[model samples]
Target: MIEVVSLIDAAPPRVFDLELDMDVHAGSLPGSQETATTSTGRRQLALGDEVTFHARHLGLNWQMTSRISAYEPPYHFVDEQVRGPFRALRHEHHFEDLGDGGTRMTDRMSIHAPLGPLGAMVTRLLLAPYLSRLLRQRAIHIKRLAENVDRRR
Candidate 1:
């Protein structure tokens, strides 16, 4: 499991709404060349929505389909992989109101690689750290956007 936490200088509703925006998600991982399309072809994801992402990662092109298994507006959501490189992957997003008009965002991912011992080794040594960094980078991107930083100069 990989966990990442970020504090954003914005209300929970704003942070949560941005997190559910597909365009923000793609923009956050510019280096990965990630693009996503939802089952409903909507820009925002809601309960039971599925999203398919195509990207280049770790020198390989990959595709993953994940469904929003659980969702509670402005508070929590879970996306579970339906098909992907991993044997299993479930990501949980949590937003907490700090009562100072700021939000605390937490991301927890449970990933299981395919195969047996070899897969376990690979996940521990490589996938875990790589994914952790990826999540952290995403958090930073979201934080900037939530704080109203206009980077398009």
Candidate 2:
């Protein structure tokens, strides 16, 4: 499990809403080339909503289907993989109100590689760093957008 924490200078509700915005999530990771394969295109995700993403990574096309398994308003949500490249993937987003128009956001990802010991080795040596970078990049993107501009405006 990898935990990435971020502080965004925005109200908890705003941060939480942005976190579930499909467009913001997709746009933040340009390198992944991820796109929603659903008919709704860019839409907000709610509890029990399943989204399939098609992405090109490592010069290979990959697909992952994730469903919003748990949701708590203005607080936290969890998305879990139904089928994907990874053996198992669970992403949890947690938020805390700082009482001064700021939010403390925490993203925790629990991912399991497919090939047992060999896959674990590969994950540790390669996938871990790449995923970590992507996670930090996404956090920064959210922070900037929340602090500087509102994309929904």
Candidate 3:
């Protein structure tokens, strides 16, 4: 189980707006590259939307497809693995209105390793710490972008 919580200095709608644009959100993350909409357009990120991602992590290339299982405007969204390296992967994202022009965002995820006991051992020894740092860095980047960078046109 992996959980992370972050507060952004923007309203729920603003934070949600950033998330709704999959391409932009994905590009903002460090080491993430070459994001594009699949043959599936408009249906790209709504509930039931299926998106494919190709990324490199730890010097290894990874390709995976994720489906949006839950979506509620300005509130929450969830994506689960339709196909990925993990035996199981589920990520939930939540947004709460902070009233003072801010949004509190939370991410909860559970990932089951692939190689049974060996996978669990590797996760406990290496993967967890690395993933935690990556997630925290992403949160910090989002906060800076949401609070200081204005994307409204």
Against the true structure, what is every candidate's RMSD?
A: 2.9, 2.4, 2.4
lDDT of 3: 0.77
Candidate 1 Cα misplacement greater than 4 A, ranges: 149-153
| lDDT comparing candidate 2 with the true structure | 0.86
User: For candidate 2, lDDT tens digit of each residue in 1-153?
Assistant: 788999998988888888888788889989888887543564888888888988787788989999999999899999999988999989999999999889999999978899999999988888887777788898998898888855476
Candidate 2, which ten residues in sequence have the lowest lDDT sum?
33-42
User: What local lDDT score does residue 91 receive in model 2, on the 0 to 100 scale?
Assistant: 92
lDDT of 3 by residue, 11-83 (tens): 8877776765666557666575636454367523678878876777777877778888899988999988888
lDDT of 3 at 101: 82
lDDT of 1 by residue, 1-153 (tens): 899999998989889999999999999999999999999989999999999999999999999999999999999999999999999999999999999989999999989999989999999999999999999999999999999945354
Best by TM-score: 1
C-alpha local distance difference test of each model: 0.95, 0.86, 0.77
